[model samples]
Target: MGVHTTNGIQGVSVSDDARNASARRGKKGLLIGSGVGVVALAAAAYVGACYHYKDAIPEGTTVAGKSIGGMTSEQATRQVLTLKHPNASTKANVTAGDQSFDLAPASAWKPDAEKTLDGVTEFSLSPGRLLDQINGGGEKIEPVYSVDKTALTTLVKKAAESKIDGAPKQGRVKFIGGKVSIVDGAPGHGVDEKKVADAIASGWPKKTDYTTELVEKNSDASDNAVQAFAEGDAKKAMSAPLEVSANGQSVTLTPAQVSDVISSTTGSDGKPAIKVDTEALLTTVLSRGDKMRVPAVDAKVVWKDGQPSVVEGRSGKEIDESKVAKIVGDALVGDHKATLAMKEQKPAVMAKDVNVEALPSTSMAHFESPFPTGPSQQARIHNITTAINRLNGIVVQPGEQFSLLRALGYEFTKESGYVEAGTLQGGLHLDGMGGGVSQVSTTMYNTAFFAGVQLDEHTAHAVYISRYPMGREATIWNPGIDNKWTNDTGKPILIKAHVESNKVVMDFYGTKKYDVATRTSGKYNIQSPKHRTVKNVKGCENTVGGGVPGFDVDVYRELKSGSTTVRTEKIHTKYKPDDIITCQN
Candidate 1:
């Protein structure tokens, strides 16, 4: 029994040992598996971090719609760009640093004013493209490239060699006749390659061409039959013989070996060559003797319509109709003849009809005339006629100024025969011809005062005299000083003057459009006039009592609707004491 119990104990021990060994092996295997799993997880995490932190961008990396990864600069910039979402809310923030600018992205994006923004450079981004990048959507983006000195130099040289420098200049290629011509390197019109390329790059079209003139030279012929023959045309060649210098030497034409003269010909479009009909051309040249006279063109000047016209003058005389017809026919067929001949003739000249605008009849109180027609009846008539003719159809526009110098250009020339006389303070005077013409000027002033024209420039005489209404007369001198006025009334006015045997009258004509009426006020503050003397070939004499008393005169014009003075001007003329000069010869 004791032996049996020991064996049982040993067996129990063996079983426990086996079970512990198995547990130890299982535990070792589980620990190895756990260690392996932890290492694998760590390795995977490391690989993921490496991928996330990589410095080199891989292929197919992109922003907006453009490819940006591992691409050469040229390949990266292969897309056309346009401003996207023109109406999109966009705000540009331009940030400037010391040497560079950071033009921030637009809030959205839009095109700026084309004119203002043309040729401007800026660095910028588009927010719409950024949003698109975040959404994995296709994008539109403006691109930028570096433009340093080296790159610009290379680009310019390449462009010049290609399209600008060697390219045909605009309009320089002139195709006339049949040949292509170009005035090479004409400065102002020459080609500039850089400008052209920039225009093309900026979406502007290149200029094409310009128009220019072409000229050819031709002259009368030469001699030395051989020399003339070398010039080609025989007829024009022998028209004038060439004059050689005093040294006797004949100019030689053919050196025996020269055969190209017969083939010379020229056309603008065709190739230039020397071609001539030597046989027939020589005959024409020899037939013409010295002194080629261009036949006289028969013509006559006659009254056609109202103007003089030149025609075939041989009409009423011994005119050969066939000969005249032949001349005209040849003229029409000439190589260099004007196309429209009839229009070149001067047509007729006619006077315009006198048109007087009808107006309400005005009547002035006719009284016993105090003014008298003085001596020199012929002179008075001539002055009155001249003044009348000048005043005929004279028109005054409202607000337009009238100058006496312009009107009296007639009185200053030698044709009027007026001589130079000394001026008195500001008075008009003449020594010889048309001496009394100032009578017309005085008449015009009186009429204008009543007609109500604005007085602009006027001068008073140094001395006063008779034959003129004391202070109411106007005096004018030639080439120097005169009276002037403006047509201030809103109406056209005409001055008509007429002189008969003993009377001179001036009448103003115009529609009562402005309702203007003028009147002279009281003549007051009269001063005793003075005397003047003149010395001629004989002696001096003082004329007495003829000098009129100086007086103050007031003239006014009433602008009215019915019976009212809308505007009034007071013209005060205080005639200085008269110095009546008496001439004694």
Candidate 2:
């Protein structure tokens, strides 16, 4: 068809194949463009979803058994607080070989949110991440936990050592059927710390119980070497009793004592060694030994501004219990006797050893004696005060006697801060050295009596003084007489005496063992006083106070521990009548 000539006749005719081909091309183009648009929209939606969950904790992520998946920083932090913290009682039981140990890690499974969330993100351009974000989460995060590294490491190492690093039993000295014998040693395996640690880490914070195997360790000292030393040491240690002295005190270690604590063990140098239990050794020595102990000063309560506060006291030279192992150990292996060097004397009463809270208060056992009045009043007060000052701060050790004479160190005379006061001699009133000290002696005796101590040496006065308790009073002379007592309480006794408001106050501070109660029988065998004339004897005071009937009496002491009486003892006293005296010129 010619377009120009057919224009007047309404165009030329086209081919049907061309028209159909043109329509097909248009339809194909539209379909192709629509497919491209759908793909582009899907990509945009994927990118937006990825950005939505940016840096979020992966869904299904759990920390220390807590679900914190898909949580934001703030939400995760708040959820971390709700995680059930590991309790102190939570323990991990582990077994290695035949020995089992418990691991009580202090909050070892504690969740660490900051560490878990640090640089964590589930959003990513990668296909896998995109798919994961769309489906919630793809990663299950391993919980980050914190622990006491030092403590956990030490515990792990200890478990390892105890499980496998056991040395061959060197042998133990034991008494068998009344004869000394050695308990044979046994072989043990060595340890592998790295192995044990690796095994423990595999299940920590997740596993509560574990089992491991130990490898063998090489020992320089064979089991035979240890047993050999043990045999020889046992023979020597059990031969005889060892009289050991430390800080002026003596304790005899019998074969039984030696056999109880002495044992052979493998040394770090791979040599066989003898080890002694210092605590058991000292306890035996102190309990079974003779009376050679001195008072150990301990902490006590003091009144400051009328308020009670614990005041710590200094310790004296005493047997060093820590070093006693070596001292007695050497003697067990070498000599049969030992006089410990002075350096071995340590403070028996350590700061930690003092029990000020349980101090035997004066309220528990208190004694107060009034000052004797008259011409000798001032002089007697002086004598009593002097005696009390000397008595103060003197501690009576268990198994040792507290002798006033020894504690005074010298006879109380006019030159030794004492004066002539009213004293009873030959049933007459006279001035003598250390006269009023009898009041002090009585006060101290009462303290010991009510405080539940052993009354070793005490004598009643000649006359029955109304002021002092009848039959309970004691009299102390210058050089001969002394009030003595022993601390049978198994604890140190501290004497704190002072003259307060005309009264001699004596208090014994120690650990309270039991409550003491006394019952005195009525006076019997009464003796009438005599009438006597003092023919101007020098220093004889004209019968200041006299004329009292004397008699025999008995006192019963009941020691009770929480309403149960442990033991009771009776004390008897015989007093001579006080004679009525008339002065003559």
Worst 10 residues of 1 by lDDT: 341-350
Displacement of the residue 222 alpha carbon in candidate 1, Å = 73
Reference-based lDDT, residue 261, model 2: 63
Which lDDT tens digits does candidate 1 get at residues 1-585?
113347356423346777789899999999999999999998776555444323222233432322333222222232112223322233221111211111112221223323222221122134433333334343223333212333333343233323322232212222223222332321121123234324323321122221222122121111232243333332222223221111122222221111221232223432332333333322232123111111122232233464443333111111122333223222222321211111121111112111232321352111111234555355545554565455433444333355554454434333543433222332223344444456666666766665654456665544555556555667665434567765444333444455655555676654332356667777688787555555562323344456656767776666564675556766667776655667656
Most accurate candidate by lDDT: 2
| Candidate 2: tens digits of C-alpha lDDT, residues 380-426 | 88888898877765555443556766565345655567877778887
Scored by TM-score, the top model is: 2
TM-scores for all candidates? Answer: 0.33, 0.40
Report lDDT per candidate: 0.39, 0.65
